[model samples]
Target: MTWTAPEPTRVGEPLTGPERPMLQGWLDWHRRTLLTKCAGLTADQLKLAAVEPSNLTLLGLVRHMTDVERVWFRWRAAGDHTVGSPYNSADNPDGDFDDVATADAEADLARFEAACADADRAAATLDLDHEFATARGRRSLRWVYLHMIEEYARHNGHADLLRERIDGVTGA
Candidate 1:
């Protein structure tokens, strides 16, 4: 049997809830939104850029967001300073985007899922006001959550455009 990517299950963001649940709901919604945009795409299709001279792609976005989730949630927000991003280095800072032409879309998606799960575990015990040290100084867990939501929301837009360019599919 041929292997195919499973369809993404998108859950709507809560219109009314407590702050934590609401924030998490929105973040999860945006995360799934990105994957939904990539549904039914092949590996090459996942690597298709929106335009010339740009490294942006749905797979790249997924890998990049995986890095983002690991960095912010596990390392920064949870105060686990030992972890480092796999997609970045001094000499290869754009590895997530630049290296994605050869990315394994299914494995990349699994990496994203693991990152999100780790992020949730890391943040489970912390209150919204919990503080952690970063290069820019102290920041609250709330800030991290908000920043991640913004990150996914922004990248999901790029994913939308890439998806549309790939097959003319639109409307989230």
Candidate 2:
């Protein structure tokens, strides 16, 4: 039997809430939205870069978002320098997107889920205004939250197109 990516239950972002919860809710919604786009796809289907010459695939989006979660939440926001890139390196910076042909789809999705959980924990105790220094200057937890949402939204768009091309399924 071929293995397919499991569907995720995505919650609707709260209509009205406090600042932190609102931001977190929207971020989580976007995260789940990405996974939803990959639901019910076999590993081979996910590995297909339906758009030629782009090298963009559903699995690659998952891998890229996994790294994004780790970098923004754990490394940057939580100030945990020990948390290194899980799927990329200076020698192969684009490994997450470029190296998915032979990748294990199930394991990669699991890793993305784990990264999201870790990211939540890392920022759990952080105040939205908490600031951290970066190579580009400084950023706050609020900024990270917003940036992550934007990141997921952009990638989820790609995921939507990829998934639709893989199969006729559509609707977010």
Per-prediction TM-score to the true structure, in the order listed: 0.94, 0.98
Query: Can you tell me which runs of candidate 2 are displaced by over 4 Å?
Result: none
Residue range 1-172, candidate 2, lDDT tens digits: 9998898998998789799999999999999998899889899999999988799999999999999999999998898989987679999999999999889999999999999999999999799999999999999999999999899888888888888788988888
lDDT (tens digit, per residue) of candidate 1 on 60-151: 89889999999898888887888787677889998988898767788888888888888999989899999988778999999999999999
Best by TM-score: 2
lDDT of each: 0.86, 0.91
Reference-based lDDT, residue 115, model 2: 95
Please identify model 1 stretches exceeding 4 Å from their true place.
Answer: 1-3
Pairing residues by index, what is the TM-score of model 1?
Answer: 0.94
- Clashing residue pairs found in predicted model 2: none
Clashing pairs in 1: none
